[model samples]
Target: MAISRITTVEVTSEHIGVKGEPNISYIYSRYYRAPELIFGATKYTTAIDIWFAGCVLVELLLGQPLFPGESGVDQLVEIIKEKCVEEDYEI
Candidate 1:
């Protein structure tokens, strides 16, 4: 079976090893990346996949990306805006 292009090495069953510092490179599309990744976090667990899954689910339900950001910083802003509205937090 062919795997989807959306899947990345970070989605494997192996545990994510702890790094001494943050990684300079980030993977995955901006719309689907977790907050930690956008902030340059390198040591992360597989739980980041849950965030990606949530984005996919939202897109599937809405027929469009929930966070169609133009850039990494814009992606973070979009995510924060949506979350603030969801939690009723002031932006």
Candidate 2:
């Protein structure tokens, strides 16, 4: 799943406690999210679809979600810029 702007996030349950089994997140839609992105006034908002496309691309290359950022802003900032060594990047 994907979200836009990340209105808010609940992290109390994400850290500590059992060291990672599973986590659930409740995301709120903002002024420039999903539907608005496609048809609303902010439909032209680039962040709308860009996130999804970026995700799929990560899945294809790394076989997983690109950035599991602790927060929304961090996630948005952490794009698929390649984690491998510089030498590995060049064929």
Candidate 3:
């Protein structure tokens, strides 16, 4: 299978304001949203796009979303589960 890549076109956008600006709208697909965005961070950097690119890369490798959350909160939970949960830890 061909590995899909995230191109500049897929990641380009024209959001108003620069980094550290307050109350910036959270406008991103939930599956590819950065952790900062999920945490309601208004002042964020372009690093969020890098996070999105990583998510896309993971999906391309696994053929599914790394964090397949149904909602915003669920997305956070998925991230926490992946990062914080131990191999022996039970739900």
Candidate 4:
């Protein structure tokens, strides 16, 4: 689960210690992080994993990352550009 971004995530099939809490760690790959994480959100949900999975699927299909930004800010910019083009928004 993406909750691994938290400092400690313990799972024993009986309990989950972490459940998408505020974790500002930069350990997670920037490419797959959800927009909320990029914006420094304190509270989030497992839906972030869905975003990560989608990014992985796209990378596998294209043989390259769909948003190959160099850093966190760059990653957000890449995502915004894609969204703009997708919604036909003027830049």
Candidate 2, which segments miss by more than 4 Å at Cα?
1-47, 80-91
Model 3: lDDT of residue 71: 92
lDDT of 3 by residue, 5-35 (tens): 5423243455543666664435567888888
Candidate 2 lDDT over 1-91, as tens digits, reads 5543322323353432231322122222221123322232322334444544555555556544555555544443343234546575642
Pairwise TM-score winner, candidates 2 and 4: 4
- Clash count, one per candidate: 0, 0, 0, 0
Across 12-77, the per-residue lDDT of candidate 4 in tens digits comes to 533321466555534257877788878887565676667877987777676677898998889988
- Indicate which candidate wins on lDDT: 3
Model 3 C-alpha lDDT versus the unseen true structure: 0.74
lDDT (C-alpha, whole model) for all candidates: 0.69, 0.38, 0.74, 0.68
Off by over 4 Å in 4: 1-17, 25-27, 86-90
TM-score for each of the candidates: 0.65, 0.31, 0.70, 0.68
Q: Any idea what lDDT model 2 has?
A: 0.38
Which residue window of length 10 is worst by lDDT in model 2?
A: 23-32
Best by TM-score: 3
- lDDT rank order: 3, 1, 4, 2
TM match of model 1 to true structure:
0.65
